[model samples]
Target: PAGAGQDQTFRADDEPEHGDLIVTEAGVLKVLHTPGHASNHLCFLLVDQQLLFSGDHIMQGSTVVINPPDGDMKAYIESLYELLAESVRYIAPAHGFLMGHPEAVIDFLITHRLSREHKVARALGALTPVDLKALTAKAYDDVPAAIHGLAARSALAHLLKLEAEHRAFREGDLWHAIHES
Candidate 1:
């Protein structure tokens, strides 16, 4: 539902990198390059106000999707940890209402993602040599069946992270867990 290219008239006057500061009337905004939901995703922090503009990194109602290739689950988790180092008291998410206790919010999101990853690992251990679809069903059994398609995307991202950590592997369309001796 992303209306990409729908507004071709819009142009960026300046490209801000991570750690760059932009002075505005409200305050000095510190650019944070948070890549996960999208490779080019950025979050702006109002330094003086201790407010973070989370963009698509963190939403009010739902967890951000980490579709592969562009979306990296590992990077997403790491980015969340990075935010913990910042002095943010409130979060101004792009899709939700302003939230208080920024650290608590970040912690919750990280814990939730890691918990889901654990579920994915358990599912993989139980259903080794299984395809992505079957594995997603087992891992995301807690969620409604209607959204399994979307869940599969996140599951794949988790599997990729596991693979990077030498905890899982894939052969063709089937995935296998790497058991340590």
Candidate 2:
């Protein structure tokens, strides 16, 4: 990751609209503002062929990691649904080979994420005022300890999402579930 950093920051002055067209020899690429994996992520959809160029928004065999402070669970789910509303025949993801059945995969990922969010909520409810590590252990108990660090990041992301929705709160290093009337 040393050389991955860019020395300069570029300003975008001509960002296309959601349905803006970028015609090329291959086909017309329709710009889609699919921000979820990151706050500024975008995907291009080929109009004629109905092909999608999903860069980190959708992975081949794995779900996108929605880490908090950068990744957003709600926005990711919304973006998936937005893609589902489109007419996508094939998905050209950044990390995987060409894949079909885009709709099914998107649906599965959405369901999986929602399920994980529920798990995080349940864990927080059962262990209020608990630190992230303890919550991660309870929430991701089925996961291997080797990947607990990554798992904790995801768990923290879910907690941040919950906080955004006003369903939970954090005090110091501990997170707590909010019980509203």
Compare the candidates by TM-score and give the number of the best one: 1
Give lDDT: candidate 2, residue 165.
Answer: 94
Candidate 2 overall lDDT versus native: 0.88
Residue-wise C-alpha lDDT for candidate 2, range 6-108, written one tens digit per residue = 6456667788878899999999999998877788789999989999999999999887787767788778888999999889999999988898999988999
Q: Which stretches of candidate 2 lie above 4 Å from their native place?
A: 1-4, 10-14
- TM per candidate comes to 0.94, 0.91
Task: Give me candidate 1's TM-score against the actual structure.
Answer: 0.94
Worst 10 residues of 1 by lDDT: 1-10
The segments of candidate 1 whose C-alpha lies over 4 angstroms from its true place after superposition are: 1-11
Q: Candidate 2: lDDT of 51?
A: 96
Clash counts for the predictions, in order = 0, 0
* Residue 38 local lDDT, model 2: 85
